[model samples]
Target: MRGPASLQGRLSLWLTLGAVLLWAVAAAWTAVHLRHEMDEVFDSALEEAGQRLLPLAVRDIIGREEDDSPDQGVATLREHDEYFTYVVRDAEGQVLLRSHRADLGVFPPFSGIGFADTATHRVYSDAALRGTITISVAEPLAHRWDVAREALIGLALPLTLIVPASLFGVWAAVRAAMAPIRRFRAGIEARGGGDLSPIPAEGLPSEFQPNARAVNLLLDRLRRALEAERSFTANSAHELRTPVAGALAQVQRLIVEAPDEDTRSRARQVEAALQRLARLSEKLMQLARAEGGRLQAETPVDIAPILRILVADMGRDAGGRLEVSLPDAAVIAPIDPDAFAILARNLIENAMRHGAQDATVRVSLSPDGVLRVVNAGPVVPPEQLARVSRPFERGATDAQGSGLGLAIVEAIATGTDGRLELTSPATGRADGFEAKFATNRIETK
Candidate 1:
């Protein structure tokens, strides 16, 4: 099966991804804009330098023909200037004055008066000395790229560190915001069947208050419905007890006073039927009590005496078919005395009724608060066992039962926070049924 997914984890993941994506887009836009702005500033500087060299080139041109040699004045401008070079040409397109670093022997052939590009450099040409002189200022494309790259790196460095830190902050905030939900879940889980009070909405976030209120409304409805059902069951069982007992007493009298053998036999059958009805009524009362709520007062009760009394009562009917194995000392557990007795009685009675006629039924209590009733009988199928704990369900259709025996026991166990385990064919006995009760705490004294 796939594992459960977490809301907090998914929210954090998507939030972080969104933040990273936004940051990347912002950074890319900044880089593009920064590169464009740097190119403008560098290009403007190139044009200004060419204008300053125009006057110097005019002076050099006038003295050039007299000297018939290249000027040395432009040589000093080349020093410590790796990113820019300049070439001044006459109107005839012959080189007039050039920087020492301008290694290209021929000046750029003029087509117009603006920026142009050769294979290695970007050239800006301007007419100076009243259009008599042409000045070209060239910068290598490699050097221009280096300047723009440095500006882009300076702009991006801080965001690279900020993005990871921002994501971490978002995760922490999300977890802290979800703390109230965790508290709400824990409060609900801690409640028992007896706790039907509405959950308090105080101190919860506004976003969660509606959910809390809705749950409280549901709990209120459930408590009222359960109260009504319990009231009906208790009143009905109480009302039937007196009438059922009166009828059973009348049947017993009929059996004793019948004048004919057939009449007496028929009266005896009626008595048996009345007895079964009485048992069913009693079980219904017990089930209602168990389901009403948790025990009001829990007291340490010794189970040895109770178990012995139950086995003795059952043995009268079971004769030699009953067996008992009690712990040497009393087993003490926190439980309701009436509830425990009812649970044990139902289990022993079920064993006697369903077990093979000649097979021995054994009732045993361990020092650790495990009470077990085992009897030789057909094993209950696994599929049926899963559902047999429900009311009015028996191991076999032919078995005689009110079908509330195991259901009552299960309810009692749940009220005391105990457990009931059923196994068909008790260990080492292939044709036996075993029912075990495990209380929450057990003490032997």
Candidate 2:
């Protein structure tokens, strides 16, 4: 046979087999009980026959002592049918009377007290003679078999109808139980790759409730990932297109129009724009790589050395607005040097862009491992301070620059389990933003 394709069919088969086994046991027990009942009825009939013969035989014995009318009453009783064999033996072990008439010998020896009888079902006892009388009765083995067959028929006929009905019921129950899973599968298969939405949980079994919730959570994560990737692509394209388009326009103008020095100077301006774009692209890529968690080569970086290097590099751009307060001791912390450089560069550059030409920018490494950067300018408001660290966010004075610098610095700080604090120090005395890195992380080297 081809096996069941659905859970319904399988469940039906298992239930039917179980029911059949139970029915077989029930039939066996019923047959045994019926045989015992029939045997009891047959043994009762034999006991009654023994009781009737007992009284008459005792009367005949008493009459034989009065000189003998030939005991015709006993002879009359012997003319009956041979359904049962009976014998009466004297105390001396001689046969006195037998229902068989002829000498078939006394009925086989039987155990007795008064009227002790043994049947195939069990034994029965009642008073028979003054001394003792015994009766051993048993129906044929074939009769017991007939009783068992009749009992089996009575027990099995009802089960024949009930078993099939039970199988059908189980099959239906199994089908109903599996319906929810099938529906879930169908719903999932109907969706396309672009469709990322929560699955409905209603009408499902309790066990499958978790599955629905898990799928919804996965969909939420997938939606967020897709949004992030799309934003990244758009931002990359826009950032790249501005520089490429400007460079192309500059090259076109240079080729098509060979005018005077002013025209050539305009070309140089375009060239500068291209250079700025290139720098921005390179910085963006660096920020991406750092935030992508790919930089693993971390070593001890001295804050003193990084500050000195950044001051030297930005000095020409700084227009002499920079000041440094060096500690007598070198301060070092464990960090990826490139990431640390990026962090320092952004902070110094932000200060240079926003601070006035006469405004002083101070860099210092604290003994407790904090690197403090303070610049002289208008202090950022408390509410707007947090805005500066968000990507693409800029302060009012920072319109000319791409707003990624503070965000990149914050990323580096967070990666190192460090904090970047922003505060508006007192005007004239501390008139600008203060960015502090933790001092406890500082290492003396």
Candidate 3:
């Protein structure tokens, strides 16, 4: 069977995906903004350095041209292991000074003060020294990219750790929120077979209260409907019993008093019809009682004696066609004595009524609280087997039956916390029907 859908799992998946997307967008924006700000800061430092060095280059060239060459002027500019390199050129396009890190030939001859790019470095030029000298500051492009990568890693690493922790918290919160639903399900599951009472609504979450109230309303309607049905069946059956019995008696008297054979035969037919009606009415009463939601007795009752009594009673009419197998020891179970008797009688009677005339009916009760009845007959179709336990349904159309036998037995089984199973071609019998009842509690001694 397919597994149940998980609301928590779906919610968690969406939440985690949304969180990841949000984090990714935020991280991307932060990286972009950080790189822009770093570029601005570094560019400003480059411009300031070029302006400062412009005036110094003019003073050094005019005062010490004899002793300080362009290379010596460049050596004097190295103050720290910073990323910038500089070159100073005069108006005549002669190199007046150059930093050690500067690629001498790669630095293009200056045209005006601005920024430019070579193969490896970004260069910014200034011509603010005596309005003639130009100083260019250049740095490797790789340096700026390295700094941006370090800054992004520092920002993203902590967030990566936090995402998993946040996902865990979301899972826990979802489970906690769903606890009320689980409790509501458990309450419904704990009800007894006949419990159609309104569900309790207190202590439930506000969001679930409306659903709970609706369920309670449905239960209330079902309870009323079932009560009406049971009451009507019981009252109608009771009211009809006296008249039916009186009619059967009158018909029998008519049969006895009839002078002609034809009249006597007609009276016997009428008596049979009256007898079928009487049996139908009686079964209706038994079905109502079985389904009346009455609490069964908790005391243990031995089923062996009941079986023996039922077998003997049925055997009178069954002649030599009935067989019974009962365990030597008593098989005791918690059940209502009246209900058990009704359930057993219906099963045995059904088997006898529908079974082949020459076929023997077998009744057996095991120590494990299983009561089984089997009888030789044509195999009942599998499709019809399920419906046979419902009211007014029969295995064969020609069979003389009220059709409430199996239904009444099923009702009693459910009320007593027992199970009823029906099978065609009864175990070890090629062409027969079997009915098995398994009680929840059984004791053998």
Off by over 4 Å in 1: 1-10, 45-82, 85-121, 125-137, 140-168, 187-193, 205-208, 296-337, 362-372, 416-418, 425-429, 436-445
Residue range 1-445, candidate 3, lDDT tens digits: 4422797777766787788889889999989998999989988888888878777777777788576555554454446766888887777777777877677766777867778888888789888555577788898888988999999899888777877887788788988988878777777776554778766666778988989988878778888888899989988988889999999999999999999999999999999998898998999999999988663666888878988998898789888888999999988888888888899999999998898878898999988889999999899999999899999998765879999999999999998889999999899878999999988878788
Candidate 3 — what's its lDDT? 0.85
**Looking at candidate 2, what is the lDDT of residue 281?**
71
Q: How well is each residue in 223-269 modelled by candidate 2, as lDDT tens digits?
A: 67865774594479467967677776766679458578777777777
Query: Considering summed lDDT, which 10 consecutive residues are worst modelled in model 1?
Result: 70-79
Q: Clashing pairs in model 3? A: 74-98
lDDT, candidate 3, residue 264? 98
Best by lDDT: 3
RMSD (Å) of each candidate, 1 decimal = 4.9, 17.3, 4.9
Candidate 2: which stretches are off by over 4 Å? Answer: 1-258, 294-297, 426-430
* Steric clash count of candidate 3: 1
The TM-score that candidate 1 achieves is: 0.76
TM-score of 3: 0.77
Which 10-residue window in model 2 sums to the lowest lDDT? Answer: 117-126
Would you give me the overall lDDT of model 1? 0.81
